[model samples]
Structures are given as C-alpha cells and as structure tokens.
Target: MRNFMSKKLLILSEVFHPENFVINDLAMHWAEEGCECEVLTRVPSYPAGMPLKGYRNRIYQKTHSFGLPVHRVGIVSGYQRNLVRKMLNYMNFCFLTTMMLLFRGNRYDRIFVYQTGPLTVALAAVISRMLYRQKVIIWSQDLWPDTVFAYGFRKTRLRMVMLNVFVKWIYKRCDIIMVSSEGFIDKIRKMVPGSEVIYVPNWPDINCKRVGIKSLPEGFNFTFAGNVGKVQNLRNVLAGFALFAEKNHPNAWLNIIGDGSNLKALKSLVEEKKIPNVNFTGFRPPNEMPSYFAASDVLVISLNDAPLFELIVPLKFHSYLTASRPIYAIVNGEVTRLVKRYSLGVSADPSDIESISGGFERLYYASQTELKNYSANAAGMTRNGYSKEKNIAMITSILWPSEIGLKQADLHRAM
Candidate 1:
C-alpha cells in the first residue's frame, strides 16, 4: 500500500464506463468515492458485436473516464458465439489481463471481480489469488454455470455440467460477494444457502441536477429504454400501444431509446401496423435521459417468460426510477416489487394487453396533484437511498471490512 492514500481497488469487470450504461455508472461511482480504482476491462463492444471505432486495433491501453483510470485489455474483436471465436475472445482477455496486471508496476489492496462471463474472469481472479495471495471479492452481476442455460447458450450437456462445477468452485474461493438486486440474493441463497451475498442495488448520479419534469402534451406519451434484447417483450408492448394508438392516435406516442438485435424487426412491425404513435429514437447520452422520460407521462419496462430475468434487475429500471415520472412496468420479479414498494409506479403483465391498456388509462387521466405526489416520492427514494454516493460507500464498506473489525488482524496488508 505504498503511497496509496486511497484504497487501491482493482476492478475486473467485463464492462466499464462510456459504453453508456449502469456498469459505467458503478465504475464512475467507485472512482468518486476516494478509492483509487483500476479497472481491467474488455474494449467497448457489447451488443454491437463491433469494437468502438477508435479502439478497433488497441491492445493494452489506458484511458480516463469519469476521473477513473481504465486499463483496457485487447481481446479477440469478433466476439460472437460462433464456437471458436467466442472461446478466443474470452480466453485472450483472461490471459492478457492477468499477465498485464502482474507486470503493471502497482500493488492493489483487494481485487473486485464483476461476473458476467464468470468463467474467463474467474480464471483471472484465481490466478491473481495464486500469484499474489490477493483478496478476491466476487461481486457477481450474474450467477453462471446456471445462467449459461438461462441465456440459452449452446453447449453440450457434459460440457455444461463441468462448467457449472468450475464456476461454483470459484465462488467458494471468494472472500466476499456483492449482488446488484434483492432477487439475486434470493436465488444465490438457494444455491449457497448459508453464503454471504450482500445487496448493493444499482445507482446512478441522481444528484447532478435532474431534468425538469414536463407535462404531457394534453395527451398520453409513453417511453421504454434499454436494450432491444430477446427477453424484452416489445411484441407485446407494441401490440398494446397499437390498440390505444388506433383509437387515440396523436393523443399517445411511444418513444423508444437504446438499440439491439430486435430493433429492425420492431421497426418493421411498427411500419406494418401503421402505428403512427410509435417512434424510435436510438441511443441517447445518460445525462440526456431525463427529458426523454420527462416528456412522457409514464415510462414502461417489459420482460418476457424468462425466470433468469426475474432474478436479475436490468440497470434501465433504475433510470426509470430516476426519471421522476410514473412507471408502467410490464415486468416480473424484483423490478415490479420495487415499483410497488416505492409507490412510484404501477405494473401490468407483459403479455397481457388488457392490463397494459388499463395502466395506460390510469396514467393518461391522472390528475396533476396525483402526478406531483408520485414525482416527489420517486425523487425522495432516489435522493434518500439510490444515489451514486450511497452505493460507493456501500461497496467500500464491503471491501475494507476490517474498517469495522469484521475481520481479524489488519487486512490492510491485503490492500
């Protein structure tokens, strides 16, 4: 810990900031909390299947984002799951990052590993522990071995069983665990029943001057943000909106932000239906997210018949909570639970048009007084608990547990 005035944290995450999502939010949050965070991350190319333009040829690079120094590892760029290519991408990252860190002229106190591709990154953590006796904190974003099957990844049964064994073995070696949602805690508890899994729900910079709330233009407008992934039941969302739009065309507009594989199909569906009220405005900057939601009287989130998503909370949900508008969440699991608990939103079944129609009506006709109450409550929830500051402190507490004497001796040596 030589001259390391702040806690020296090594974050091994598959994703990082400026890719524009909650992983970035957490990374930025960690950097702001007086912790000297060094992230070993893959180049920005998730969902897009292409590396960010400037970084296409980069290998072993360092850059600053949100005041955090990010160390980038060059992984195989063609990251799709075409068997050999996918294996190469994951392997190269694990090998390169592990080697880079060993040679990089710094001593990190404790290493925090974010699990999305748990196997490849777990190898890095295991090697780190073996090489340096480093403290390994597995802050799992998703539980693997089981999740491979959940995401419907292609693999032989025997291979999956072996993978599961390896992933669980890595979990057992971790010094601590932090999960992003309440639902993850429940699911992981069922697996490692007595294991330690702390809840550190996703946070964004909620205090950096939120967008002013605007009134719906004497008509109902709805919006949905986040990935256009397989699990996002836009089929049902578009269907419900069409029924309302057919009757009250200009009175309603459905604005979608974010992009994904399902985008082209969704656009064609809108054209075919002549759904005049629906509009697609691709990705927007995180700071610009406020007006996008504020312009709408209500925000919507949708999920399909996947038990895995139920156990996972998408970061977009937090953005909706930050929007300071009512959310008509078509979701199951913890998101709906949060929506109801916060008294900030209402929910309907994702597949049920009748229920969604009913929710649209309530939002469309809601009095100014009622909307005021919801906005105030949503802002209060964000300010009182879910700001970036709160999450940073929570994670720091988890890292330096000795600060509270939760561990014997000085774990400062680990730092």
Candidate 2:
C-alpha cells in the first residue's frame, strides 16, 4: 500500500455511473479517502446493448462524477443477445482504452481493474503495465470461461485452450486478485499458481429500511427482483411456482420486478402455461426495492445450476438479507450453504423443479414464528460482518494497507 496523498488510482470497468454498479460507491469512497481517483470506462451501456439516450459513442469524452474524473471511450453496440456482436463490443473497448492509456495513462500510481465480464477487458490493464509499468489490481466479479460456458457456449478443445491461456495470462500479470466469493479462491489458484487471491463478498448498496409499502395482489406474495436473465433460471422458477400454485397454494403469487434478455420468453412461457397470479412489474431502481420486498411474504434469489453459478453469492442475496425477508433460494453450493448455515430460509437445487416447488411449499406453509426466526437470523448475520462499511474496509485493507495505516487490531477497533 502507498500513502493516499500521493497515490493516484485508475479504475477500469465496462459499466459505471448510470448503470447501477457498486463500483460507483467504491470510487466515491476512495475519493473521499483522499486519493485522486480516475475512472476509465465506456459510455453507460449495460443490461441493454443500446447506449443510454443522453450519451453518444464519441471517440473519447471526459466528465466528473462523485468527485472523481471519468473517461468514456468508444464501444460497439448491439451485443446483448448476439455472441459475435458481444465480442466486437469487448474488442472495441479493449482497443480504444488500450490506445488512450498508452498515451495518457502514465500518471497513475496504481490501477484497479473491475473485471465484470469478458476477459478481454484485461487487455487494457495488461497494456497499461506493459507501457506504463503501473501495478494492476483486479477485483473479478465473474470467473471467465466457466461464465463463458454458462452463457451457453459449447466448450470445444480449441476454445477451451484459448480461454485457459487467456485466463492464466491475465491472472498471472495482476499484482493482486480479489474475488467476490470464497468459492472462487481455489479456481483462481488452479488457474494461476502462486497468485495472491483474497475473498471479498459483495455488500448491499441501498439502505434496508422499508421506504414505503406496496399494495400487493391478493395472495401470499413471493417476490424475485433484479436482473431477469437466463442466468437467473426464471423459466424453471416459473415452472416450479406454477406447480406450487396448481397443487398447494391457489392464492400464492410470484412478483417479478426486473427486465433482461429472457423477459420476452419468460412472459411467453407464463402465458402458455396460463400461470395464474404471476405478475411482471418490470425493473425498479435500487431505492424503490424495499417497498417491493416489504410487500412480499418471501423474497427469492435464484440462479441456473451451472458450475460457475455454484460459486457465486449474488449481490441481491445481501440486499435480501438486509431487507430481513425470508429467502426462497433456488440455488446450489455456496449460496445454499449460507442459507442453511444461517437458517435464512429454504434452499432448493436450481435444476430440480420438484425441489424448487417443495421449497415454495415449505415456505408457504412455514409458521409465522418460523418465518420471524429466519428474518431475525438474517438481520443478525449482516450486523456481525456483512455491512457495506465492513466490506469496503476489508478491500481497503487488502488493496492499501499502508495507505489506511492501520493494523488488524486497529482496523477491527475502528469498524
């Protein structure tokens, strides 16, 4: 770690402000800590491939937000559902950012790579190091190749070889690698032997207190919020919920509050099944989520039963805990482990329709006392160690121990 007064940190990510990434919060906090922070990212385009209405893909643009300087670079559009187009977008960002950094990125003392997706983004950091020799620290949210495969790409011999080589090269070059899940540690070690890997789970960005209550449809409500994508495995969740409704709870309702590529297909499935009492409320902003959670009897967090997904504890999980709502988790591995260990709620294998249906049934029939117990455990767990302040402090400790100037005891005492 270096002193904050002199150290200038550059943040690289594909998404930033106007896109609802936690990176915005991290950058703001770092700036507040006295470091001169700069962000190099593309014009806000996420969840949807088209750029936000007010922004355009200029060759290069500069602006300031939350007390930090931000550089926006050119990006290819029309990539959400098309793999070829997506690669073009990643390649375009890498090319444009690499050129800019090679010329103007020499001043930063250190660089932080916010690795969200597409390992190709590593090219920007790699180029920075090769040309400017800046130390690169990576905080990877999603593991590559496995994530790539989970996106429905077939793993061929040639493709696997290229992906492994790319992943290893990127991991080997980073000064430090921080993963958002403990389950990602072994894979990082296997991919890059001797790499310094640290676990830093995600924290909820919004406050937990219910801002307002919603008038929900007449029924026992179960709400699933956030990105309604294929990875969420909503098709199966709907199927299971349909089964649960048909057999167990006719008055049960599932409220979905988000949008994504699968939204159309999911809506189509609901219609085909004639699934009654299922409501799609589209996407809601972070601040308004509490009201939705408050309106629900149970909040759901789910994912596809992919190898990569098993390792992830989604960001929504933290928010769900903070909301103090009993969770119906259609997930496996680490997420399931946490739910079971903390007694947060019921868990089911994402691939098993019967298992998911049973989970809904179990939660629906759970005694009010039992439900209260789950909510209490969730609130208690967050207070102990999972707050946003604790998570940010943990990252600071790993990324800038000398700058923070606190020993382990001092850090704990401060928290």
Candidate 3:
C-alpha cells in the first residue's frame, strides 16, 4: 500500500464542499488517509447565484474543513441569469487562482485539478507548471471548445481559432490529463496529440441506504434528480411524459428534484402546458437523496442531444445505479449504450419526443420480474464496475507513482 503521509497535495476546483460535488468526497478521503491536502476554490455559489449560508462572497479567505485547508476566492453574484456576470465569474476565478498560486505555488509538491467547467480554470495550473515546475494533473469533467459551443456560444471564425489554440495550450501543458468518461480519451487525443490521457470514471458519492421515510407519495413514481439546467434536457422530458401520461399512464408521476437556473422556467413550462402529475421539488440536502431514490420506482437521466454530451456520463448515473432502481434514460451515446448493454433500463433519443414517450410506456408496463432483473443488474454493476475503493486507489496510485512503485509505462498500460 502507498503511504500518503508525507505527500503535500493541492486541489483546484471551482466548486467544493457546501456545494455538492464528487471532489468534496475525494479530497476528504485523501485527508483521512493522512495526506496533507489543501484546496483553492471559489466562494460557494453554484446552481444558486448568491453565496451559501455561513459564507459571504469575499475576495479571499481561508478556512479548514474535514482536515483540509480551504482557500476561497470571490465570484460575481447573479451569474445564474446573466450571461455577462457568468462570464465574469469564470474570468474572476481564473485570474484570482493564478494570483494565489503565484505566491504559494512552491508549497505543494503536486497539484490536482477537479475541472467541472470552463477550461480557463486549468490555466492557473498550467501557469504554475511553467513557474514552479510541479506535476499538475487535471480530471476533466467537461471538454473545451466543444463544450464552449455546446453551451450556446457562437462559433465565429475568430472565436473558433482562439478556442482551439487555448484548449490545446492548456491541455498540452498538463503533466497528466484524467477523464471521467472513456469516450473523452479519443477526443482529447485529437486535440493534443501524444498527451497522456487516462480514463478515471467517477464513482457514486451518494450512500445508498434503505430509509423508512416515504419521501414520495404512493403510486408509481419516476424521479429526475440533479440540476434542472437547459443542458439537462428536462423540457423534452416533460413533454414526453405529458404524452405518456395523457395516453397510457395517467396516475404515473414525474418528480423533478433539485434546483438550477432552469427551475423557474421549467415550472413555467409545466403550467403553460398543463402537464399533470408533475411535481417540482426544489433543492434537497445531499444526505436526503437516498430517501428520494428509495421512494422512486424508476430514475430518469437525460442530457441534450449534442455530440459533446455523447462523450460524457453524468455523476448521477452512478448514484442512480447505486440506488438499485431501473433507469429511464432519455439520452443517447454512452449512457444509452450502457443501459442497453447491461440491461439496466430502457432508453430513448433525447431529441425524439415520441421515442421518449415510448420509453416511459415500456417502463411503466414492465413486469415485476423484469424490474427486479434490472435492479439486480444495476446493483451488480455498481458493485463490480464502479467500486469506489478501486477507483480511488487507481487515482491515488497515479498521483503518487513513486510511492506505489508504478513505472510510467506500466501506469499507461494499466489504463
């Protein structure tokens, strides 16, 4: 076993604890294992534009949590609705994180970046590598240039050229690039040839437990949990459910859990369309997700029908699998392939409303034997394929190669 006792590590992320993300659990686990760890991140403001409770948006502040020192930088408020403020928020974190690292870059032996969005966040790590020559590893949750355009940015000639150049520059500078989806490997290699890209998928962060509380009322329930953003494609989901409810399953309910920028808009859409049996529950505590999942008859996962989205797997996939509920996947590409291959659930194209309605109909009429088989397959997949301990050990081994006695060639071959 590798001893993390003496290793000093730094984690850079735009979101951390106080805002739910897998990075929070990963950092805490490393600390408990006796690694000296610290974080450089923004003040807690995500999904919601304002600062979270017990926190004020400050220029810079230091706090400790879960045995790790956390250094936070300020972000522009009200970015949830304003495009300009959102751009500024991304820019502010990039500039401020660079400044923070310029002074303290040499303190840590290595740096790990938990990149969720905006490739610009990795610029600071790239700059640190140029200045301090530390090993920098980034776990890329989003692909740049493609993601930039996917999020509604116009791909002007000048903008495309600049983004291509910026993406290559940032990625090529990193010592190692880790991706959460296997599909990201080829795409990233196409961007930066010869770059060491490794597939390190995210494990489930939610602890699946049987709780006595009935979070949802009786009757068959289909729950969609997580952010309610445009990229989540909930509008299409709602429309499909409306079609299904009108014709086939009138008593079936669709529960939209959690909150995001699109929550109000979705509620408006529900009222505008008069979609029945649809409940919009605002944000719920992370600890309470198990109960909601436990109460659900089937879990829904969807994303916009974009090529960029095809290569990504949302963290909620693993969480839903851990809950051992059959999935109703309104998605395409990787998630769809997985669902069909493993017999985990039924799937439909995100862009096709009729197909989605058919998926709901199929799940609604599925026999108890079929549902149990799906549930058993999901539980087995979570235990065998997405084992948290195995994934974490793989990451830590790569992070401290010498401690684990892994040669560079062997590490590449292991992946």
Question: In model 1, what lDDT does residue 320 have?
Answer: 71
TM-score of each model, paired residue for residue: 0.84, 0.95, 0.97
Model 2 / residue 35 / CA error / Å: 1.1
How many times do residue backbones clash in model 1? 1
Model 3: how far is 23 from its true place, Å? 1.4
lDDT of 2 by residue, 284-318 (tens): 77778888888888999999988898898888888
Indicate the worst ten consecutive residues by lDDT in candidate 1: 406-415
Error of 2 at 249 (Å): 2.0
Residue 363 shift from truth in candidate 1, angstroms: 2.3
The per-residue C-alpha lDDT of model 1 at residue 249 equals 53
Runs in model 3 lying further than 4 Å from the true structure: 1-5, 210-212
lDDT (C-alpha) at residue 391 in model 1: 72
- The number of clashing residue pairs in each candidate reads 1, 0, 0
Which of 1 and 3 is the better model by lDDT? 3
| Alpha carbon lDDT of each predicted model | 0.71, 0.85, 0.90
Please tell me which predicted candidate would have the highest TM-score against the true structure.
3
